[model samples]
Target chain A: MTKVTMTVNGKSVSAEVEGRTLLSAFLREGLALTGTHIGCDTTQCGACTVHVDGKAVKSCAVFALDVEGADVRTIEGMANADGSLSVIQQSFQDHHGLQCGFCTPGMVMASAALLADNPKPTEAEVRHHLEGNICRCTGYHNIVKAVLAASGQDVPAVAAE
Target chain B: MFNFDFVKPSSIADAVAAMAQTGAQALSGGQTLTPTMKQRLASPSVLVSLTGIAEMKGVCLGADGLSIGGATTHATVAAEAGAYYPALADLAANIGDPMVRNRGTIGGSVANNDPAACYPSAVLASGATVVTNKRKIAADDYFVGMFSTALDEGEFITGVTFPVPEKAAYVKFNQPASRFALTGVFVAKYASGVRVAVTGASNNGVFRWAEAEAALSANFSASAVEGLTVSAADLITDLHGTAAYRANLVKVLTKRAVAGAK
Candidate 1:
């Protein structure tokens, strides 16, 4: 095992990690940040998405040692300083973006990254940007709505939701 | 994944030295390698990550055309290569998803040379030069077969220089589940002639459709190759598509690529 150090969620954290330890495992086990989910260990599912140096990436596909001294962020860091929900998270809840909350963390993280890059993304753009993320429960109708709402765009309500 | 020692080198020389060690494997973006490791398919004793080398990143337009660092992420290529080579940028933009693009690098994809990958079609069709630590190789001689390349052990790609084409486009019929091409075609027209490369269709891996090239070079139009057909004999047949289906796609996509070239 080797000691890996990084700024996680605005805090400098260091841990002893095996060379094979994934960043998702490191965050969930080493630092005790369970907010980042791991639905699929493979790269297909985006449940393990997190921001490494301000860019969203699949934490499970990255070795912890590879991100040494990098700045990392998780869903836990999305809320305001008072710990209330951030705009994206609030929008997700308000729009019923999730049914099973398993994929929420990754969805929120990916959405936040999208808004950062393209603040006013269209409906097609949001769907395209979220191609990596999978949500079985919601059929992705409301999830797309939530992301649009988060971007301050007026989202039309679907009768199904 | 098997436990191994890890090293991140800040320079190419140091990275090469580290890779020269026994049982050391070079790791690029790890988009592909990490998953392979998790599956226990690849277990290196020491993983030498090449992302730390500052010099091996970014996209620049040189006298030859576009020079992209080996370690440069697909996202960077999508964002930067548009002005110089918009077709390449479009291909890069559509690779995998946003998160994967952020982590997957050009060198990793080209070096891994997955039969369904997108970059090899672009590289081979554009007549790009694969620059490595040891020497520069022409695209024609770089790719050997599926998941294989001309690269020897300890020799890693540093950058690739693509000769800008007068008109170029890449058209892919992606396997929706994985977003890899079921059969992709790239057509590039230069002053000298036309080059056509097809990926994801052939068992022999990415290859130039010489017949299509000759036809397109003579006419430079979609109708020029209307009568041409790819033989189904060497095409891949799997649950996703049949060899004949892939063979048909090779022709259809090539026509679309030529018509769409800008």
Candidate 2:
């Protein structure tokens, strides 16, 4: 086992982890940051998305030991300092972006990363960026609307939503 | 994933030394290796993480064209290689997805040489040089077969030097589910001649379409290869597509790639 140290959600934390311990396992099990879901452990689903050193990546696809001393941000960090829902989270909630909420953390994190890079993404750009993230519930219409709303763009109301 | 000792080396020399140890495997990006390990397909006693090596990360334009560091992530390539080689940048941009591209490295993809991968077609078509710690291998001799390369055990790619082509483009008909190429073609036109590489189709893996190359070199047009056909005898046949279907895609995508070459 290796002792790994990293900054998660702006807090420095240390954990004893096996070399095979994935970041998702480290977050959910070790740090009790269960917000980062692991819907598909095979790396196909984006339910495990998190930011490492400001770039979003699949937590399950990375080993904890590899990211030692790096800054990691999970879904738990995507909130205002007052513990209120972040703009993205509030947008997700208002736009009815989620159904079962299993994929919400990942969807929010991935969208945050996309907005960080391209703040004013178009409808097509939003859809393309979220390609890795799978949302079986809402058929992605509302989720796309939520992401656009989070980016401060005017989103059209979907009849289904 | 099996239990192992993880070592992140900050230098290429240190990484090389770490990889020389018994049962040591080089881990760059870990986009593919991590999943494979989860499936228990690869279990190395020690994993040498090469991403920490600062020297092996970046894209630079030199006399030889674009020299891309092996550990440079796909996102980096997509962002940096655009000015030097836009076609290559486009290929890197479309690889996997935003998250996978953030973690996947060019060296890892080229080294893995997955039959359906996108990089081999770019490397082979551009005739890039795969530079290793010990020696450099030409693209022609670097790729051997499916999931195989000329790299020796403990040897890892440090970078690749691509000679920028006058015109180049990569077109892939991806599997809808996996987004991997059902059949991808990369066409590169150099002053000397045109080189065409086909991936995700051939059983031999990422082979050059010589007939298409000859026709394109002579006429550099989509209609140049209208009469050409790839034999289905050597193409891959899987649930995604039939051998004949892939064979047809090879011709069709190659034509499209040539026509779209910029």
lDDT of 1 by residue, A26-117 (tens): 99998889989999898988999999999999999999999999999999899999989999999999988999998899999999999999
User: Residue A81 lDDT in model 2?
Assistant: 98
- For all predicted structures, in order, the TM-scores are 0.98, 0.98
Output the lDDT of residue B61, model 2.
98
The global Cα lDDT (0 to 1) of model 2 is 0.94
Off by over 4 Å in 2: A157-161
lDDT of 1: 0.94
Q: Against the unseen true structure, what C-alpha lDDT does each candidate score?
A: 0.94, 0.94
Scored against the true structure, residue A143 in model 1 reaches a CA lDDT of 92
lDDT of 2 by residue, B196-234 (tens): 999999888899999988998999999999998889999
Q: Model 1, stretches more than 4 Å misplaced?
A: A157-161
The TM-score, computed over Cα atoms with residue i paired to residue i, of candidate 2 is 0.98
lDDT of 2 at B29: 94
Looking at model 1 chain A, which ten-residue stretch has the lowest summed lDDT?
A: A152-161
